[model samples]
Target: MSTSPVTLLTEDDSWEFLRTQSVGRLATAVGGEAEIFPVSFAAGDGVVYFRTRPGTKLVELTVNSRVAFEADEWGEDVATSVVVKGTARILETDAELAAARGTGLVSFQNDDKNVWVSITPTEVSGRRIARG
Candidate 1:
């Protein structure tokens, strides 16, 4: 099946797709090489949130905030995917942390104790397999 590029998702579609999925892959550069990590996330108000432990990748995210994230689902002969390119920022404020915790979508047990990262998408696109 082939797919076509559509305009950026509407607010409703974006929120719906994001809320339906619990996990996504975050793509970033590590040591000048591409790296992708699967993570559980929550989305709302045009921002995607997730938590991660301190490490080199986290440091890289802090230093270079640009990233791409993708989530998708597939079935027999059909698939749909969404990609978001955005700027990431570590959530530091009590309000933001509280909001992140409110997502209630954490897969990891110690998510609340980990550092929360939030991505505000500059662009978002989605595609679905064309019917044959």
Candidate 2:
């Protein structure tokens, strides 16, 4: 058990936390502007997968592959957050598509989200905040 109110989680712990969650925010930059979108995601094997339509989110990610993703959960007095700084790429190969599908990622909305995006995290960090 941690004594401190704020506990830093290891990379493995962060990924494990992410695996339990299905929604996150994907942040990207395009033309010096920052864009963030709430996404339904799945995580496995050090990769985060999400489905998106051919729209702003897709275009922005293409222009800037560098991205930051965040997922969090809040309880009565404790909150846990995980941040993943990574490179985002649209899955093109059959293997990549299969892998993304293997994670069982599905769109929360009934949209034609045929495009799959995978974020390979270069750095993953998380923290737990507890109020006493």
Candidate 3:
């Protein structure tokens, strides 16, 4: 069976695709190496918010704020992906944290104190592929 290749996505389509998912891969680079981690996120007011533990990964991200976040959907013969290029910043203020919490995306079911990270997208793109 032949597989279809990825397609270039438009800005509006990319944003719309992202709105359909609540989790995506967050890609970052440090020491010339790249890393991509799956993260649960919420989008609001043109910002993406997620919670992570405070540690080395967080430190590395702070030092290199530029990142790419992606979310996608797949079916038997079709797939769609959305990618967002942006800068990430730690939300330190109580107000900022509270606002994120208010989004109701964060689960209080867990005991971990959530540390919020916000990604402001500078570029967003998406693609859809189908096989007949």
Q: Rate the local accuracy (lDDT) of all candidates.
A: 0.81, 0.94, 0.80
> After superposition, which runs of candidate 1 have C-alpha atoms over 4 Å from their true positions?
1-11, 108-113
Model with the higher TM-score, candidate 1 or 2: 2
Ten consecutive residues with minimal summed lDDT in candidate 1? Answer: 2-11
RMSD of each: 3.2, 1.8, 3.5
> What is the per-residue lDDT of model 1 for residues 1-132, given as tens digits with 9 covering 90 to 100?
744633346656766888889899999985688888888898876788988888866987977889999988777776678888999889999999888888876675544447889988988877666435
Lowest summed lDDT across 10 adjacent residues in model 3 is found at 104-113
Stretches off by above 4 angstroms in model 2 are: 1-3
lDDT of 3 by residue, 71-118 (tens): 888999889988889999989899888877765674324547467898
Which candidate model has the greater lDDT, 2 or 3? 2
**TM-score of decoy 3:** 0.82
Against the true structure, whose lDDT is highest? 2
Candidate 1 RMSD computed on C-alpha atoms after optimal superposition onto the true structure: 3.2
Q: Give the lDDT ranking, best first.
A: 2, 1, 3
* Candidate 2 structure lDDT: 0.94
lDDT of model 3, residue 94: 90
lDDT of 2 at 106: 66
